[model samples]
Target: MRKWGPLFAVSLAAFMLLIDITIVIVALPDMASDLGSSYTDLQWVMDAYALALAAVLLGAGALADRVGRKRVFIQGTVLFTAASALCAFAPNTATLVAARALQGLGGAAMFATTLALLGLAYEGRDRGIAFGVWGAVSGAAAAVGPVLGGVLTEHIGWEAIFFINLPIGLLAIAMAARLISESYGDREARIDVPGMVAFTAGAGLLTYGLIRAGGHGWGDGLAVGVLVGAAVALAAFVVVERRTAKPMLDLGLFRRASFVGIMAGGLFTQFAAFSGFPQVSVWLQSVLGYGPVKSGLVLLPMAATAFVVAGAGGPVMARIPPRYPIGGGIVCVGVGALLLTMVDAGSDWPVLVPGLVVIGVGIGLSMPPMSAAAYASVPPEKSGVAGGALNTFRQLGFALGIAVVGVVFRAAVENSIDGTPAAGRDAH
Candidate 1:
């Protein structure tokens, strides 16, 4: 119980950080109005964080191992707290976006360390339970982010969303310093600098291309150049990884079929889940004419259901094969999207609840098992790298998901508007 206390506290911090990633979406309008920014700037407010997170995660893990995980974790907490304060006080979109990017840097440090900490603190069933709890807490945070963001934005201001992290970050730092033990990965391995650069460049370019294409069309010259640059950079990354003595992400990990399948499943599940939420939130606000707080309230059940279901996955895994949960969970996500597809301008809270609940349960079941499976497949020495790689893919998937779904939603909204300009204009 004593050991578990630190694990729970760190996990809670992790949950808070992850939730902050999406929570700001509900408050975007208020933020834009307050700061007097354009839509592109609003998109930057989200993308900048994600880009920094994805860019630094693998390198951050290696750095954590080289230094001390506890030391790095505390540093990350301090940085995140400081960044949150900056975000709270940001006077313009540029400042807010810059602060968010710094926040992501801190978040990447903590995220890379926390999973490794979990690996150290618990074993077997206990470990499974810890991971389950981690997933549940994270899912719950994501679920409630909208509601919480909405309430804070409405009652106080958009700044409350960023300010809220200060206490949580401070508490996490204090607890980590006193309670957590130190851990590290293989220090002897050489850093794959070229691979890291190539991968980061590739991912950034690709993400930029997708996002720009969504707004400006694929024919846009900048979008076309970005896409080409991404492809070239990715090819160079593969080459660097193959030629390098020590690669950040070992290509050989994919040889194991179970690992490959589970990783693929993880990517797809995140892609689906990440894409669905923002689209739903937009529909709630733009189409249904709900205030941010009301939309958040409507999302509450989804988060609660995910928390309950995800926490149960650990116990269930003890009795059943992981594939059952993974497959079933993926199916549920698909079904939830299908239900969301049925949404129209007139749809209400009751009509949305069941689908959101189903989606949450599906996500809860899928995420933990996939993570556990991926972690378990690697050698103990390589767990840090493997975990880093898995998270990188998941982040990549999330970035892509947002781009893809934003495009879809934009197209749908435009088409709907084209059909009836008055209705579509009203909806926006």
Candidate 2:
């Protein structure tokens, strides 16, 4: 019980951070109206956090190892809490976007250190249970984000969604202080400055290009240049990482079959399923004529179902073969996405509920085994990097998923725009 206490606390903090990623999506329209944001700015509200998260994650793990995981975790919690306040009180889209980026920075620190902390704190069955609980919390949080955002946006304000993090953050901080002890690795690696620069720039350029292509046509020269530059920067990143004595990311982890497959599956599942929630939230509110609160209520079953399945998944995995649950889960997620494709302007709860449930279950089953497999395959020395890479890929999947899905959904909407006269066009 004592061993599991800190694990629970860190896992809880992770749950809060993951939840915020999706919570803001449902609140975006309300936020836009209040802040008077343009469509591009609204997209930035989502992208900025994701970009910052991906940018800092690789470095954050190394920093945690060099400094101390607990120390880094405390600093991150403080920063995240402060950033939440800034986001809650933000007066303009610019302020909110900046705050969200800060929040992501903190989140990267928190997430990167979390699993390492868990590994340090627990052993064997306790470790398994802790990770299982962590997985359940994450899935449940993702499932709840939409409903929570909707309810908060409708009842209090979009700001309430950000503000709610305050209590959770505070509690997690207190728990950390009480339950967790600090630990660090022996080797101290130098910062891979060039590698960080290349990776961040490459990811940013690619994401920016995708976002722009959603608004401007694909033929737009700036968009084309951005994408081209992204490819070049990524190539440079690969070169830089290989040559660096202390690489920000170890390139060797890809050699393990289990590691590679788990990472790939994680990316694929998130790319296919996780990206669709925000779009679904908007579709429910704008197209289905559902109120924010109602939209959230409609999503409650999905969250609830995921929580249950995810909680049970660990025990289930104990008895079953690893490949069966994970592979089956991936298939379930893909099938759910296919069903979701049936949703349109005229769809209702009946059409949305089944698909959401399928997705929730699929995600619940896939994530834990994949995560466990990734960790199991790595050498103990490289656990930190492996964990960071796994999370980096997961986050990258998220960012890429949103960018790609956003483009597809936006294009679909634009193409479907009927002969109705263009309404109040904003003065450029």
Candidate 3:
């Protein structure tokens, strides 16, 4: 366990950051009431974080390589913890939204470096186990978000959701400083400023348009223009990456199908995660009237199962080709999503548990192996940038998943209410 210190530090830090990604879902209802936010505003509360993370992660990773991963990682902890405080005391929705964006910026820095830290600490079979453990912790944290969020939001108010981060972030920061040794990805890697600017504009604009279009109708001219502008900027970014001698994103990673597939797996896994969890939470609280604790308990099976399955996947991965286990895991998640679609307004906990378990199992199986493979594909010197590259896709997928869920939810509700009485709509 002594040798596990740095791993524990990185994992704990990651857990705190990952928890924030989904925790706000359960708190949204309370925030809506307190802040007088519309559905779009509530979606922004989620999107703002994802957008900022996606925008800056590539640069953050490169910065880690140029300077030191531990230095950037510690800085991220300070910024994230401070931003959480800002969020807790936010006076209004706009303040909360801005704070969330800052939190994401901090999270991007940590997210960019944690995997690199893990890689530095472990090797060969040990690296595999570390990834399994990391995946389990991350999967469990994400799965548990709504339940924790529900408990906090229900009892202490929505602000408590942000407040909950205070102790965790501070403790993680302290532990990381003491236990984790400093490392660099590449001392020679210069910050690619122009590449950073192009990717940030491209990713941020596109995601904003998607979030808006999901909450509002696609007919909005602003969404259309933003999307088009984003496309043009991303095209420009590709040109910049190809031309820059030391790019923020190594455009060359796309040359390998295996690496691209591993990254795609990250994208799909996050897409599955965000799209399903928050939507289900909305169904549980708003449609079914289950309280936070009870709803959380109902969702516990998935988290528990996922944690176990992820730990187990390491052994299975040792014997099989990595792709097989990863593919199998994604397939399990899809099956779970299918089962969850059968849920109705009056469905009980028994009806929900099976699907959650299946998805949990799938997440456990896929995330570890895919992550391991992603790290292995790049040279160790590029670890921070590589991790960032993979996560950029993951967070972008997360943002898109939320938008898709919002669109589906809105459309479904509109259709459900089209012919209903006003009282029935209110009751619904």
Check candidate 1 and list the clashing pairs: none
Which digits, one per residue and each the tens of the lDDT, describe model 3 over residues 206-281? 8788777777757778878988999998999999988988777777889999998988888887887657676676
- Model 1 residue runs over 4 Å out of place are 411-428
Kindly report which residue stretches of model 3 are placed more than 4 angstroms away from their true locations once superposed.
Answer: 411-428
Instruction: Summarize candidate 2's per-residue lDDT along 1-428 as a digit string, tens digits.
Output: 46667977887788888888888877877887899986568778887888778767767776777678888888898899899999999999999999999999999889888877877776666666766777788878877888888889988999999999999999999999889998876356666779878887886677677666655657889989998998999899899999998777777766867667888887788788778777777666665557777777777776777677778877567456568878988998889878888875555667877777898888888777666666666555445555666787788788677767877787554332222323321221
* Candidate 1, 337-411: lDDT as tens digits: 667667766666678777788888888888777767767777665566556666767777777787777776766
Write out the backbone clash pairs for model 2. Answer: none
Using all chains and alpha carbons, the TM-scores for the candidates as numbered come to 0.92, 0.91, 0.93
Order the numbered candidates by TM-score, best leading: 3, 1, 2
Better of 1 and 3 by lDDT: 3
Query: What local lDDT score does residue 42 receive in model 3, on the 0 to 100 scale?
Result: 75
lDDT, model 1: 0.78
Error of 3 at 350 (Å): 3.1
Worst 10 residues of 2 by lDDT: 419-428
